[model samples]
Target: MRIITGIYKGRHFDIPRTFKARPTTDFAKENIFNVLNGYIDLEDAIALDLFSGTGSISLELVSRGCQSVISVEADRDHHAFIKQCLKKLGTDRCIALRGDVFRFIKSCHQQFDFIFADPPYALPELPTLPKLILERGLLKPNGIFVFEHGKNNSFEDVPGFIEHRAYGSVNFSIFSNREPEGEDE
Candidate 1:
């Protein structure tokens, strides 16, 4: 995969042969960042990338100037690939951690300005991620948590769910902390 934009744009990294993680496609990524560009002040944000896979999202965040990014991955190869990418990009702004995402979520107490979770679509517990995050106060008061999933599932009924967007077969559910303008007191 390649860094799509910013100072590190055009950089490339290979997904290790041993890595079984599925990466977000370039098409979806471009669109995601486009949306992010509208609401995010990249330099002021702290990002968390859970179920990090090949770290595409993290790298993209870093490229766009996020202050710091914590990438969490469980697989050894996948985690290593993230570290490798950071090193290659000469980015000291990101932290790559190897651990189970669920366990890591329970253990982490620090809050982030943005949190992105792209868990395995087939995982039965997928529906609970937003609740888990809210219960733990992982997102800042006005932060966003984006969950990427396959097209088969929809989060429209889930509380705190603000918006859902689809880019081809890739889908994203956005949860936010801000109330819309002109809402009730």
Candidate 2:
């Protein structure tokens, strides 16, 4: 996978064949960032990347100028690879952690300006993720959350639902704690 833009733009990382994680496609990644660019500023924003397969999203977050990024991946190999990548990049902006995403969510008390989760689509707990993260107060008042899932899931009816975007088979549901414009009391 390769970063689409920012300081690390044009850099590429090779994924091992034995890995089971599905790194977000370049097409989907590019398009999602395009959509995000219209809504929030990445510069100086503290971000979190859960289910951080290959650490692609975390690296991208740092590339785009996020003040800091925390990447959580469960697999030992994947976690090591992420650390290796960070070292190669000579960047201290991202922290790679090895652990279960759900457990991390339940224990995390700090809020972030931007959060992204790209859990396995087939994972049974997929549906509950948005609610779990949002309910835990993981997002600051104006923070944005982007959850990546398969086409089978829909979050339009959920609270904080901003909009949904699709790129081929990839789907992203965006949410924010702040009310949409013109809805303020």
Candidate 3:
């Protein structure tokens, strides 16, 4: 996969066949970023990428000039590949961690301007990720959490859901920090 825009535009990485990630399609990624462009300044943003699979999203964020990105992946090989990719890309802005995404969220004292999660499609617990993130307070005030899932999944009924964007088989359910009902929680 390659970065489709920004400073690293046109740079490509050959993901080994052993890698199990289904990297976001360039078309989808570009479209998503275009939509985001109107709202956020990448250089002013801090991001978190859960299940960082191939590190593609993190790299794209860096390429687009995010202030920092914490990218977490549990697979040993995937973690190694991400590390190697970061080194080759000269990216010190990304913090790569080898750990369970859920556990990381629970333990983190940090909050991100944007968080992207792309869990395996077969994982039955995907629906609960947004709730988990909220319980752990992983997002900054007004931050966004974008979960990428398969066509069959739907998060529209979820609390804090702001929008659902689709590009063919890829679906992004976006949740923002909910406005507290009373007393500011």
Candidate 4:
């Protein structure tokens, strides 16, 4: 995988073949960030990355100068790889944790300016994530959440959903914590 922009632009990491986690496609990731750049200032954002496979998104956040990032991964080897990647990046801005994504979300009290989740497409709890995060107020006012999934899922009817973007087979449903004034709840 590669870091597409900012300080770490063009940097690449060789993920081990044993890793089962699917990293985001570089094309989709680049396009997603391009869109995000129009709305959010990455330099000032505090971000969260869930099911942080290979820590690609988290690393990209740090590279782009996000204020801080918390990356949560459930698997043992995946977590280890993330740590190693962080160490090599030489930045104190990201905190990598090894734990269940759902449990972490439940216990997390801190809010973020940006959040990204890329869970396994087949995971049964996928549909509930957007609501869980929104209801729990994990995202600060005006914060954006980007949930990545396969072509089978759609978040158009979801309350906080702002827009949906697709790149090949990758799908991203974007949500915002702040609803417009006078809009229905």
The lDDT, on a scale of 0 to 1, for candidate 3 is: 0.87
lDDT tens string, model 4, 1-185?
99999998888899999999989999999999998986678896999999998999999999999999999999999999999998988989999999999899999999999999999999999989988988988998889999999898888888888899999999999999775688666
Q: After superposition, how far is residue 69 of candidate 1 from its true place, in Å?
A: 0.5
Tens digits of lDDT, candidate 1, 41-146: 6775999999999999999989988899999999888888899889988888899999999899999999999999999989898888878987788988778888
**Best-matching candidate per lDDT:** 2
Pairs of residues clashing in candidate 3 = none
True-structure RMSD for candidate 3: 2.6
lDDT of each: 0.88, 0.95, 0.87, 0.92
Best by TM-score: 2
Better of 1 and 3 by lDDT: 1
- In model 2, which regions exceed 4 Å deviation? 179-185
TM-score of each: 0.93, 0.96, 0.93, 0.96
lDDT per residue (tens digit) for residues 1-185 in model 2: 89889999989999999988889999999999999998899999999999999999999999999999999999999999999899989999999999999999999999999999999999999999999999999999889999999999999988999999999999999999985568657
